[model samples]
Target chain A: MPMNEIWNRRLKKYQSMLLRYSKYILNDHFVLALLFFAGGLGLAYSNFVRNLPQKAFWWEQPILIIILFLLLHVGKLASLLEEADKIFLLPKDYQMKDYLKLALKHSTLVSCATQLICMLVLAPFILRGLQWSFGMWCTLLVVQCLLKLSCLTLVVTSAYDTNVKQFLQQFCFRLTLLIVLAVGLYLNLILSLLFSLILAVVTNYFFNKASQRHVFKWNDVVVYEKGRLMTLYRFINMFTDVPQIVGQTKRRKIFDFLLRSTSGNIYLFLYSRSFIRQSSFSGLFLRLLFLAGIIIFFSPNYLFSLLIACLFLYLIGIQLFGLYLTFEDNVFTHIYPIDESQQSFAFKKLLRKILLLAWIILNVIAVAKPLFKVEYLLIPVISLGEIYLITGIFLRNYIKKNT
Target chain B: MTLKINGLVGGYSRIPVLKDISFEVNSGQLVGLIGLNGAGKSTTINHIIGLLEPQKGNITIDDIKLKDNPKAYKGKLAYMPEMPVLYQELTLKEHLELTIMAYNLDPADTWKRANELLKTFRLDNKLDWFPANFSKGMRQKVMIVCAFMTKAQVYVIDEPFLGLDPLATRDLLNLVDTEKKRGAAILMSTHVLSTAQEYCDYFVLLHQGKIRAQGDLEELRSIFNDKQASLTDIYLGMTQDGHANE
Candidate 1:
């Protein structure tokens, strides 16, 4: 059994899974909402960029270096190793270097593409804000791609050498990356490009030597692979149910006081505790709220702010409808002595309160923007009305369809 | 004060798993529903707990059917499932709270009972932690505490001794004994023939969805015509004789 066949089969299956979930991710409504969000941000960004003084702000180069450096650390090594491989592939340990070489090559291709696209997006600011030459911008792109290659090498190196010091792999590697990126933006592009080239070469060479020196760290590698897979699954989970990812529970003891005030209604107690303690539910609510808050905070005009706020309210309400079925499989829910209709009513009450909180936060941001006017009072009035629609009709339809 | 299942035919799907099952667990009686794996013990229990609707016949508690009055029927029953079904986001204490809230028990009163049971199981100190993350035995203890704390008239417990330690198992049996004295009707299913032989007032030996033999220990031995046979031997004998007849 050649490992190449194994890698190809896994990559194919992995890709198809993503492709299947991508349809749900980019549904028309979500895409439209994302476009509106991006358009609003773009307007604000261009406005800010146009108004920039002829001289760069003192923090401009440092901020650019930080952004690009963080982007360099975006993608991880996708080993695709499963827990069963420890036993089944144990006899093939000698060939693991070849298998990992394939993994490294695949990761480099994906990550370099990511670096290239991000550099393209940041190209405008690099060109105008920093006033760099086209040649220097191209050099920075090359340096980003090279640095990303180095990042993958560092990750792969840790797989072969479990005893690799955290200081060496994590801190020093990141410190060197920051320094190189800072030098590239602040001092000279060619020198920084030269440094990253050497860094990438050294790390890849170290990977080969370590692979020869050490046995395959099967447990560590499998755990690393699972971590990477879970990260992907967690992201996709934001859009739809990913069975591979389980929602984790946190104690959240500080919110215990909130429970004291809640009545002893079965669904009310269950839903509130579920929302606050499960990372998936509360994380979704907060992530959407934060995104919408930022969008509305920079909303170019009153009408756009109103549009964005209402759109996000609807999105958050729909996403949270999943909470209703959280206890669907629990035997106690079916066996409990509570009235059946109370479940829906309690769910609606919680949903209304949550959306209304979003409404206040968003409307405050929209109205509190720099160009406030009395006429903008209509925004709050209309959004107050939007909350009722989302919590009432929108939620009703969502619940009806899902159930 | 009686739990009755008469001609109860049901399963997860249209095809019935429990066929013509009839039994009565009257007040103060501990009925051991003994069975092998896949012997429809759980299906029968699911029917009793109102999780599965009847395909043909009816299940009633004191002449009150689940379909006729679900709240009143369920309010009188407490179920401890084989696999612990816990709220992932709930703490150990919150599980008690949820139970009390769902059952409409006075929290002030149930909490006192819950603390004593929790102490008996050595789970009193785990109140603030999430029981969903507990060890298997610990989770089973949490389930026991919740079910017994409910103090309902009818207790339906399934395979409660699987993961419990000797001490916890003894504590559980003692709790069941006390509940029986207090007039709770318990219908427990288990493969632990030894314990069931001693504690259960009556036995309903289920084999392949049908009651093969049901009696007290002496009666079960007499049915097999072996006066000295243990419950395990009697059960194995009954199931084997069933296969021979088939």
Candidate 2:
């Protein structure tokens, strides 16, 4: 069997997964929010651009170069290589080079597309702030895409040459990309484009040499692909559940003080520690809390702020309902002599505590704003009532339904 | 008898894996549960720990059924599963603390015993580390420490010696001995026949979810008509006969 066919199969499956999840990600409310946000930002950006100084600002070139450099790091080589592929495809080691070529081609297309979109966003600033001609802007875009290509090539090359110092290799590639872009923005645009093309060629040549010199490092390549996919899945997990992204854990030693009061209670002890350390739960909580906080802080009316606060509180409450089942499969949870009723009670207590904190922070932000109308008092009161509704009848119904 | 299962019939689902299984572990006794793969050892342990309900019969601790008083029944028992299941987010210290609270043991006294066990297992320094991130052997050690730390009246340890090192193996045996002398009833399921032969006071050999023979070593040797046979030889002989007819 040809390796290209295998690569094709994986790529198709990966794209289909992304397509299915995109429906969840770009749902109606999210799209509406995005439209409003983008429209508001665009209006502000155009206004700022219209009022630009007659001459180039001193930091314009530096800022443009830095922003453009950061955008280049947006994408990487999507190998679409699963862990099982190493074992199942071991006999096709001779055909791996061909498989990798297909992977590189797909990665280059994706990275270039991302670069193009980012360049389009920066078009107004580049064209107006720096007073560049369309031709020059297009040339800079080409230079950015080429730099991205160079980055992707270096990644693919490292997969073959496993002996190299990975950190140094990546650092040097980044440095080269920075220097090349800095030249394009600061000096001759056409000359920098030439340098970027050369960099891409040199990296591709190194990839050829590495692949020729080394045998197929199946484990390293699979690990590299998994790391890249996990990063993507983590980003998607912010929107909806991605079963592939197991929540990561961190020992936030500073948060020990917050867990002190939960000493005697078994479920509270487990739930609180899990919320703080497991990235998925805490990350979702903070994201919704602050996202709603920002939107409320800038709301034109108290009603909108209240709506946003209530909506996010519901979202966070429902999202964290998952934490209840985290220990369901562990036999110790069942075997522990603690009363089974204590689990639901302890979980509700924890949820109330979490939602109450969000309520206080959101209300504080809402009240701290300069609005002093007596009706404005209703924001905190209504949201306080929302907290009760969520913790009282809402949580009970949820527990009943789920259990 | 401190722990007793009377004519227990249970499995994961409708079809039973353990059939008419009856056993008793008296106080201050160690019963080695001998079985091959899929020999219903885990199913028995599960029933004792109340993860699986007995389809037909009942399991009781100190003559009290789990159905009658679950809190008291579970409070009197400690279980160490063959595969260690740990909360990925909890520290080793938190795990031990959770166990103490779960069993409602006195923290002051339990912590003292827990500290000794931790040092014995060389996990004293890793209290703040997540035991889930530990090596297989160290995780098994954490399970051991958690189970024995409860100082419960009856302990159900499943394949307890699978991943332990030689030094840890010795330490575990000594710990078990101490617990036994304190009148704890231990029912251990393991494949290490030699160690079981040396330490266990009784043997319950199970084949295909049914007890073929059970007694002390000499009694087992007499049943097989081989007075000089080690437990391993007797076990092999048991399994060979189990497949001979099939």
**Cα lDDT tens digits for candidate 2, B1-246:** 499989999999999999899989999999999999999899899899998889998999999999999999999999998999898999999999899888888999999999999999999999999899999999999999999999889999999888899999999999999999999999999999999999999999999999999999999999999999999999999999999967
Instruction: For residues A200-255, write the lDDT of model 2, one tens digit per residue.
Output: 89988888888886588778888888888888887677667787755479999999
TM-score of chain A of each: 0.89, 0.91
Q: Where is model 2 more than 4 Å wrong at Cα?
A: A28-32, A50-59, A82-96, A127-137, A162-172, A215-224
- Tens digit per residue, CA lDDT, model 1, A244-275: 75557888889889777666578988999898
lDDT of 1 by residue, B27-146 (tens): 999999998899999999988998789998888899999999999999999999999889998889889988988899988999999999999999889888999888999999999999
Quote the positional error of residue B183 for candidate 2 in Å. Answer: 1.8
Give the lDDT of residue A266 in candidate 1: 83
What docking class should model 1 receive?
Answer: medium
Error at B198, model 1, angstroms: 2.7
Model 2 chain A poorest 10 in a row by lDDT: A28-37
Shift of residue A240 alpha carbon in model 2, Å:
2.8
